[model samples]
Target: MNGRFDLNSLPMCGAKTRHGIPCKRKGNKKNGRCKLHGGHATGAKTELGQLASRANAQKDFPDWFFGKPVKTEYVIRALSSYEKLVELMLADEIDWDTVFDVVEQDQIPLEMLKYYIMFNVTPEALIIIQSALDTYYQETHAPHLAFHVYAPMIVFHKFFRQLSAPDREYLANWFKKYSSRHPGYNW
Candidate 1:
């Protein structure tokens, strides 16, 4: 006999059923199982089986499967609402005083407030908000609140490019004064 085993020379799986009938099909070269009983055998092909397959796939990625809102999704929704407010303000539907009132009341969240000041406020609107912040700071004697209000200027400094020269100078002077008052403050 030749030393090499050819495909034809490979043995059948010869696996028996409960009734003891031979499998009769050709076996795999590796595992020696018939194609029907091989590990590569396909799952069920029925509609119900397909649905179960899809469900199993979804189970592997439950977040996408359940359509849950992620952290960025909530931020996007908040920015959308903020954009709507800015639109109304620009259209003269809502006045600066109302926006200032919202900030004074602490109705706006700190994160959204930072975005609002950086992206949406005009020089004129900024003056009003700054004045309100000054008043709040004086009344409460809370330098931290002032820091919180201006922290966005440092964080979103790129937005400073949109400011007029006078506005930029004013903000620089403000920061200088704030720093002098709170020498230990890093911001």
Candidate 2:
């Protein structure tokens, strides 16, 4: 035998048997874990890459604007609303004397007082609301607008009581005053 000896007892060298290194099973085209786990392993990554590409297609705005530009068409359209809101917000000075008289004597609901002054809800309303909240805090030592600072959706389920004692106190007092003295209420 030309000095080459085939040892059948030596675990079958490259044995041509079903268990010999599992012979790259029939449908295992890409190797590694057969057809089940080997198909390029990238569909999700490719989809994410495409998504990122699309997202990056637009020029990013300044980081301060939260990816939104300052001069979008909506801003232009809201200019008039902004003006109206501001006008409504700062139209008149608060008359503490009248407020006290109404509260102490007239026994009117303060919310009624709020409607007397037109309060517009628009982009401009933001500043007005802020100013109102600030003034309420200053006058009553309480917070008037609790949900204004947080995402509106998130604040829905929470009450101002969840805030710090001082914040809660302020909001409560301010709301009380607003509901009692503001003459512009609709209801």
Using TM-score, give the best candidate's number: 1
Consecutive 10-residue window with the lowest summed lDDT within model 2: 147-156
lDDT of 2: 0.37
> For model 2, how does the per-residue alpha-carbon lDDT over 131-157 read when each residue is reduced to its tens digit?
543454566665433322221111112
Listed per model in order, the count of residue pairs whose N, CA or C atoms clash below 3 Å is 0, 20
**Model 1 steric clash pairs:** none
Runs in model 2 lying further than 4 Å from the true structure: 1-88, 92-121, 143-187
Worst 10 residues of 1 by lDDT: 146-155
Q: Using Cα atoms with residue i matched to residue i, what is each candidate's TM-score against the true structure? A: 0.25, 0.20
How much does candidate 1 score in TM-score?
0.25
**Error at 98, model 1, angstroms:** 9.6
Error of 1 at 124 (Å): 1.9
lDDT of 1 by residue, 55-155 (tens): 56654332322233324543454345445445545664556565555444442232334444545654354444445455545655754342322112223
